[model samples]
Target: MSDRRLDDSEMATWLPTIRFVQLLPQVLDRTLKAETGLKHSHYAILVTLAGQGDRAIPMTELAQIAGLSRSRLSHAIDSLEERGWVTRTSCSSDRRTLTAALTEAGRELLRTAAPVHVAQIRALILDPLTDAEREQLGAILAKLTPGVAAAL
Candidate 1:
């Protein structure tokens, strides 16, 4: 059997959407590395750990929230630890459970990095959209996210 080709209407939407999805991350990563000496993945890990405040998050949970595999998260954590941006501890409730928490330096890093990220986001995405378009985009992504997540 042959696959059906996308018609013009579908191509019009999919082409730009796919291109933007593929390109935007690279753009952000380049900007992040240039200004902050961090890649987008490392930035994501820092942000995730920081979100939990004074508490440490278990490795499994952190991996899930960061959308990274255990091994990948482990490597990221190791790098972050080297930078004093993150620290890992054994969960007191379960000694075998390794946990990660953001450090003062990590928060400091975020203080520096978040603005760069936000500025890029505003310049690239939010600023370009009108209020209604932004609302519609939010709605559209909300509708699509579940199925996309389920597939993963």
Candidate 2:
């Protein structure tokens, strides 16, 4: 790694972005837990599964999409399974592969949780952004995603 430190200009930009990254999740988790008894990760898993045409997704792919480690996802799946919100099964084509599917209960929970989650998201993040700023933010984040993922 280079020894060069972040300059004042870079620090000014980076500090708030890092702070937002740290705080946003806490805010989201708090709202979801209070309203629905679901953590943000659980809610994300449900939303991802719901988007997958209600079909089972392989555990590995699900972890990637959710930005979780395999072990963390497995543990979350276990909790969700106990709650009857998710199910895991061995893949028919590849017995070594496991798949996760959202249950009817999960769908119901998501339907109820989504509006409240969305409103919080708007209040915390989107409501402050002008249309052009929102578009710019999207573009900037899109450019960052690949590097962040690779770093992870």
Using lDDT, give the best candidate's number: 2
Q: Give me the runs in candidate 2 sitting further than 4 Å from their true place.
A: none
Q: Write the per-residue lDDT of candidate 1 for residues 1-152, one digit (tens) a residue.
A: 66999999999999999999999989999999999999999999999988899899999999888878899999999999999999999999899999999999999999999999999999999999999999999999999988886665
Backbone clashes per model, in order? Answer: 0, 0
Span of ten consecutive residues with least summed lDDT in model 1: 143-152
lDDT score of residue 130 within candidate 2: 99
Spell out the clash pairs found in candidate 2. Answer: none
Candidate maximizing TM-score: 2
Give one digit per residue, the lDDT tens place, for model 2 in 27-131: 999999999999999999999999997689999999999999999999999999999999999999999999999999999999999999999989988999999
How many Å off is the CA of 142 in candidate 2? Answer: 0.5
RMSD of each: 1.8, 0.7
